[model samples]
Target: MRACTFVRASKEVVDVADVAALVKADLERARDTNVTFSRHAMRVVPVETTCFAGVDEIKEACKPLIEKHFKSGREQTFAIAFERRSNNTLHRTEVIEAIAGMIEQPPNKVNLGDPDLTIMVEIVKGVACLSVVQDYEKLCKYNLRMVAMTKEDREHAKATANGNAPAPGTKKNDEEKPAEAAD
Candidate 1:
């Protein structure tokens, strides 16, 4: 957990969405400025609440948060992202199932690829951090290095988008080499 720093922003900030919005704005600004000031900060994930690291605790913690975000008759796509470090008591599928079961089925659905809201469950040691976040995937999973793209990176991205060049390590797309005859 050397690289990970958990901060209770809700104490100062109004809501979890505020923390996420602040992060998004900072990342957007960094990208716009093309600054690589973030060296070791790989990813900065903001959780809404934290509870004792247990399935029951996690369920209890998520209940109100789930209700707040996934209201009845409100159509929304959601996905559960569970990451555990130095903890083995909690099962991945079990946690996902419990959280998914809490949400309204018809009105809300699970979309792994693109979800309107993401229930982030992070179990570190004896604490289970939970958060309902928007744009979870679009922000490169909240990766600073990925979001704050440099000029060369932007150009490579543009070139790759136009099919004018292969991405970093990829070979030429139009080139073909004849198979060597087996000795």
Candidate 2:
């Protein structure tokens, strides 16, 4: 499975395993401590993008998908966010207008603040990763991923997965729950 790891460290220092560890730890700790956690920052979700040469290209590729995925035929809020990376000629407003015209209307009008549906267009090297989101979440600052667990740390990870409490001197303050293990 192709996976995208999301975290707050440089690409040089992080990988999928690190993100997975964070996910496992977050879930386990949340389970034990009765704390709430959102997959928003710690899980992988589908992100769709379409490649195009310019603004017109984006419209052709993204319009139909936007229509099908937009689904908010009024009674809902929606908005579009645009980003250009590859020395494009068109303006941001033009991109917004191109895509917005396809989805915006009536009660489901443009609501930039807390929109029920957020369409994001991120263009890098002429490739656009445009996606529709009901719940908007972002990667860590500067899109940094997670830091990894060292080899010496592997034993502790195995112990936790086996439903054992963390090795002494290895647990975080919030994960120091003496009441339960693998809750």
Candidate 3:
């Protein structure tokens, strides 16, 4: 697997190579193996690393870089995401809204979700590529595993699969329950 490193370090555009080297060094310090560098997003500084399990490690490796580069007063949130190219059609706006909602911030206050001043990673061809998020939340939402079906839904699906009818008290439609007996 590949890892992507996004940097929100500087307002002035910085070289991709510098970002890549910073990530490589960080991963090396962590004793990561089989590492390699990948591409970056336009106007975003990112470095790709190879053989990473996931973005968690990539995020850990980036803390020092973030402190060093993104020293501006604006509180910046940096994130990393990974996926195969085949699954890359995630919508950018939806992600921003979800993230904004999660953080309780307005989307516009968060700035354009795309080309977000952070890094993103995608795994393709066995290489971890680094790119910038045009929308920060865009990549973030993909990381959300499908909402686990509600308990009711899971029970229903299980019942159907087992060829059983809904259990008692498991109404198929929403209805006001009968008044409970007085305790």
User: Where does the lowest 10-residue lDDT sum fall in candidate 3?
Assistant: 139-148
Tens digits of lDDT, candidate 3, 109-156: 344344345444554543445444333443223221111234365456
Which of 1 and 3 is ahead in lDDT? 1
- Per-residue C-alpha lDDT of model 2 across residues 3-82, encoded as one tens digit per residue: 43423555554433343335445544543444436433433323454576478888988876666666646477777766
Question: On a 0 to 1 TM-score scale, where does candidate 2 land against the true structure?
Answer: 0.49
Please give each candidate's TM-score: 0.76, 0.49, 0.29
Model 1, residue 16: what's the lDDT?
Answer: 33
For model 1, which pairs clash? none
Q: What stretches of model 3 exceed 4 Å from their correct place?
A: 1-51, 75-83, 86-109, 112-116, 125-127, 131-183
TM-score of 3: 0.29
Clashes of each: 0, 0, 10
CA lDDT scores, all candidates in order: 0.80, 0.56, 0.41
Return the lDDT, model 3, position 11.
34
Clashes of 3: 10
Model 1, 86-167: lDDT tens digits are 9988899999998898888888888999999988998898889888888877766766776778757856765877888756
Q: Decide which is better by lDDT, 2 or 3.
A: 2
Give the best candidate by TM-score. 1
Which candidate gets the maximum lDDT versus the true structure?
1
